[model samples]
Target: MKQRSEQSQGTVYGFLAYLLWGAFPLYFAALKPATAFEVLCHRILWTLVVCLIALAATKQLRFLRDLARDPRRLGTMAVAGVLIAINWVVYIFAVVTGHTVEAALGYFLNPLVTVALGVIVLREKLRPLQWVAVGVGVIACVYLAIDYGRPPLISITLALTFAAYGLMKKRIGGSANALQSLAAESAVLAPVAVVILAVITARGETTFTTQGVGHTLLLLSTGIATAVPLLLFAAAASRVPLVTIGLLQFITPVLQLLCGVLVLGEHMNLARWIGFAIVWVALAILTVDSLQATTRARRLARAAQGAAC
Candidate 1:
């Protein structure tokens, strides 16, 4: 009963995280901001503000002090900060430009790339099934590339940049919290946003309208919408295991796929369906291998304890 309850709680957290992220496109579209760049600026600027609020509420100021003292960790965070910002910009661009279909593809391809990067960068060994999973996923992407007659740059960029951000975060030691890190990163970029706003206003390139209060308020709320899900995700991450989180990541892509087809009215072609099927099969294989691997690790640890006595 206790086990079931724990699992249920984890499920709830995972679901909340996925649901928020999955529904993000609708919120972004509702904002109807000037351009993706403007939306990106608000996302960064407001995300920073949200982070600072969380940091204050949590009293993680001590962590901030330590971060200020440690240059190495701070430097790594700088790289992570930039990559995540780039990811934010690209994602907003996808939503704003009505190419959410491409953004969906990017997220769908993210997990496979992260797994492949683990093998290449961390020198992790993949099980047979995992290797096959990786192979199938790669083949699917290759098919897309060939069929499209060009590389899937948006998908690849989002995947690789996010994966790199993950890696950089992993390497940073100590209490450099995600929310705090994001806030700091956004703070770093805030000046550029201010300057751009100034330049655009000077050249009459700014999109804000004094005549419509509703539209202006909607644009401003993009920050809250962008920041809230992330805060929820951070809260959920502590309560959930990595595998659960990994599985939940699929929800965003699945929703995007639905949104692309139904809302955006993207056509479904045979090649696209076949490619998606191959990717799904690969992910299934990987998920099974991961479950087995986790079980094996637990058993081995118990056996080692028994031997120790």
Candidate 2:
């Protein structure tokens, strides 16, 4: 019963995380006159501030000391920080520049990119169905390229950078909790963020100061916007099964896609629709394969327990 309750809580946490993430395009779109770069810098610095406060409140500052002593983990987190920074800037650019649909497509493609990264970087082998799903994903990309008259660079970059960031987090493993990890990443990028803000201010191009109180508050609120969903996701991950997490991940991209098409009024031609359809087919294939694999693993565990008894 406790486990079931935990799982239910996790589902709620996961849903809220994805819901907030899905609504990000609207938030970012509202931050007009602030260039993506300016927004990213503010995001990094403010997120660091928020993380520090959370760490202090939770009495988890000791993790920072531990992280400092571990050079390898620190270095890995630094790289992860860079990767996430890239992802953030690109995503913000997509949202602010009327490329929300492309942003949605990128997230939709992220799981497949993660699978390919596992095979290439982690030396993991894909199951037959997984391979087929990946193949279909490739075809979808090709179709999208043909339809767009060029590769979907925004989508591809978002997918690749985010997948690489995930790999870095995987390497970090359980060495750090989500709050600690985010704090460290933000710290690593804080110096650069400071410099960027300074440059923007010097050039008189910063929207933070010129944009009125409400806009200034909106920019400041980016910190909470970035941190809350991540914390919720961490909470969900701790409580839920991997399969549940996997299934719930789709909520984010699906919401983004809906926001882009229905809310943002992004134009989606027939070709683009067909391309998205193909990607969905690949995702469906992958989902089924993951579910079956989880079931088999559970069955094997049960059979082993029965044999031992």
Candidate 3:
């Protein structure tokens, strides 16, 4: 019963995390007076503040001390931070500039991008089905590009930057848990974020101060918006199976797509819909391949256990 309860809780946490992430378009849209760069800067600054507060509150200051001592880890995290900042700014630009559909497409392509990156960067071997999935993803991009008369730059940029970030995090291994790593990344980026804020303020184009109480509050909430879902995702990951996490991850992009078409009223003609359909088919193939592999691994483990007996 306790195990079941924990799994249930994990599912809820994972769902909530993805739901919030999917709904991020709405949140970013609310910060109208702020440019994507301004929001990105504030997000970095405030996320650092929140992380510091959490460290103090939870007595996890050791994370900071340990990070300070490991120059290699710090350097790795610094690179990861910059990559993530790029991802955030681009995503924010999509949301705030009426490109939510393109943003959603970006995330939809992210998994396939990650898989291709694994093959290239990690030199991991892909199964036949996985290879087919990747091929289909490429075809989808080509189709979309032809339809648009150009490459979907926003989508490709988001996928590449995020894939690079994921690779960096994976290379880092268990040097820091989720929260500690986030705090460290934010800390690494904070100085640059502060400088950006200063420049914007000097230009008298700053939105946070001039935008009134509601807007200021919305800008401040970016920290919470960034942190809370991450914390929830961490909690879910700690308790759930990897397959479950993989499946849950799709909820985010699916919701974003819905928000784009339904809420934001982005135009999706037959060509765009066809492109999206191809991507979904690719994702389905990948999902089935993953499940089959997992099943095979489990069956092998059971056979080995029986042979030992």
Candidate 4:
């Protein structure tokens, strides 16, 4: 009963996290005239400020000292920071340039990329169904490329960078909590952010001061927007099974796709629809395989307990 309650709470947290993430296109769209690079710099610096404040409030500032002592882990996080910064700037560019649908496609493709990375980098073997899912994903990408008359570079880049970032986080293991991890990544990027902001300010091209109070506040709120969903995701991860988390990951892309078509008025031709459908089919197959494997593991564990008893 306690486990079920925790799972329920986790599901709620997961939904809220994805909900916020899915609505990111709208928030980013509202930050117009700021330029993606400027927005990224503000996001990085403000996120560091927010994380530092949260760490201090929670009495978790010591993690930073411990993390600094571990050069290897700090280096891994630095790489992760660069990867995430790429992902963030690309995403902002996609939104500002009205390619949010393509951005949505990238997130939809992320799971497949992660799985492929596992096989290539971790030397893990894929089950037959998993292989089929990945193969179908490749087909979808090919179709998309043919339809677009070129590769979907935005989608591919987002998937690759985010998947690589996840791999780096996995390498870091559980040595740092979510807040600490985000704080460290923010710290790593903060110097570059400072430089960017300095250059922009020196040129008098910055939108932060001239953009009106509402816009300024929106820019300031970027930090909270970045951190809240991540914190919720961390909470959910602690309480829910990995399979549940995996399934819930679809919510963000699905919502982004909706926002693109309905709110952003992005055009989608029949070919694009067909391509997205193929990707969805692949995701469905992957989801089913994951569910079946999880069930089998649980059954085996139960049977072993019964035998021992």
Candidate 5:
């Protein structure tokens, strides 16, 4: 019963997390006229500030001292930080340049990429259904490429960078808590961000310097926008099985796709739609396979317990 309750709560947290993340394009869109770099800089600085405040409020500031004692983990987080920054900037570029649909495609492709990484890097076994889902995802990519008359660079880059970021974070293991890891990453990026802000300010080209109050606030809010979903996701992950979390992750890109088509009014050709459908079918297959596998594992565990009794 406790497990069930945790799962239920996890579902709620995961839903909120992904819902917030799915709404990101809208948030970033509102910060427009600010260059992606400028927005990224503010996001890094403000995220660090907010995270520090949270850590202090929660009496979790010890994590920082612990991290400071471990240089190797800090270095690993530095690499992860760079990767995430790249991912963030690319996503912002996708939104601002009106290629949000392609951005959505990248996220749609992320799970497949992560799975491939797992198989290759971790020597993990994939169920037959998983292999089939991956194959279908590949077909979808091919279809998209053909339809676009070229490779989808934005999509592919986003997938690769984010996949790499996930890989690095996983490799980091439990070296740092979630907030600690983020704080480290933000700290690593903060100097660069500050320099960026300084340079732009010196030239009188900084958006915050020149923009209206509304725009400045929007720019500053990137910190909250960046941090909140991550906090929710961390909470959800602690309570849910990885498989359940995986299922919920799709909410983000699906929402982005909707925003791109309905709100942003991007042109979606029939071919692109068909390709997206194929990817969705692949995701459906993967999700069902994960659910069945989890159910089978639970059943086996219960049977073992009964047999022991």
Candidate 6:
């Protein structure tokens, strides 16, 4: 019964996380007049404000203080911040400009890239099945790139940057609260945004002023959209197994792909379908392995508990 309850909680949290992420394109796509760069600036600025409020409310001021003195993890997080910031900016550009399918492809490729990053950066060994899954994903990308002539650079950039960000965050471990890390990262980007916005304003080329009041707040909503999901992911991650969370990662990309084909009207040719089928098969292999592994772990744990009792 206890196991069932935890599983249910994991499923619920995973779905909610996916739902928040899946619908993100709608929010970003609404800001038509403002370019992705302009919206990115506001997102960085407001997320910083929200992160500050969270720091004050939680009284984690000391963590922030100590963070300044700790160079190792702090520097790692700074690199992570740059990576994710670039990712967010590019993702926004992709979605706003009707490249939602490419954006979805980026996310779909991200997990496989993250798995590769684990091997490269963390020296983690993958199971044989995981290696096969990675191979399938790579072949799918290669095929897609061939069909497109050039590489899918937007999707490739998003995947690589985000995968690197995930690896870096994993490197940071549980030492920092989600809010604190976001605050620190936002702090890292805030100066550049200020300078850019200032320059844009001085030159009379600012989009924010003329885009009307409605669109501006919608852009601000991006920060909340970005941060709130991370907090939820943190909450979910703490309470759930890594395997369960891994399954949930598929939800966002699936939704984005649907949105692209049905809503945004991106062309889905035979090659795209074949590529997606390859990805699906890879995910199936990985997910089956994960489920089998989870079941074995549960049985062993329960047996150990019974022995103790």
Candidate 2 local lDDT, 135-196, one digit each (tens): 99999999999999999999999999999999999999998899999999999999999999
Off by over 4 Å in 4: none
Residues 1-309, candidate 6: write the lDDT tens digits.
897787677678778878889988877778886778788888899999888888989888788788889998789878988998899889989988888988999998888888888898889999898899899998989988988788889999999999988888878878887888899899888899999888878988777768788876786676787788888887787777888799888999999888888877889999888887887888788788788878999999999999999
Question: Across residues 1-309, which tens digit of lDDT does each residue of candidate 4 receive?
Answer: 999999999999999999999999999999999999999999999999999999999999999899899999889999999999999999999999999999999999999999999999999999999999999999999999999999999999999999999999999888888999999999999999999999999999999999899999999999999999999999999999999899999999999999999999999999999999999999999999999999999999999999999
TM-score of 4: 0.99
Clashes of 6: 0
User: Which stretches in model 6 have alpha-carbon errors above 4 Å?
Assistant: 1-7, 303-309
Q: After superposition, how far is residue 277 of candidate 5 from its true place, in Å?
A: 1.0
Q: Please state every model's RMSD to the true fold in angstroms.
A: 2.3, 0.8, 1.0, 0.7, 1.5, 1.9
- In model 3, the Cα lDDT at residue 174 comes to 82
Off by over 4 Å in 1: 1-7, 62-66, 305-309
Q: Least accurate stretch of 10 residues (summed lDDT) in model 4?
A: 171-180
Best candidate per lDDT, number?
A: 4
* Candidate 6 positional error at 282, Å: 1.1
lDDT of 1 at 32: 69
Q: What is the RMSD of candidate 3?
A: 1.0
The TM-scores, one per candidate, come to: 0.90, 0.99, 0.98, 0.99, 0.95, 0.93
lDDT score, candidate 5: 0.90
Q: What is the lDDT of residue 309 in candidate 3?
A: 100
Candidate with more favorable, higher lDDT: 3 or 4: 4
Order of models, best lDDT first: 4, 2, 3, 5, 6, 1
lDDT by residue for model 1 (41-139), tens: 766676767767778888875666677688877777778878987887788788777877778888887877888899999998878988888899889
How much does candidate 5 score in TM-score?
Answer: 0.95
Compose the digit string of candidate 3's lDDT tens values, residues 47-135: 98888888889999888888889899999999999999999999999988999999999999999999999989999999999999999
Clashes of 3: 0
Q: Which ten residues in a row have the lowest lDDT in candidate 2?
A: 251-260
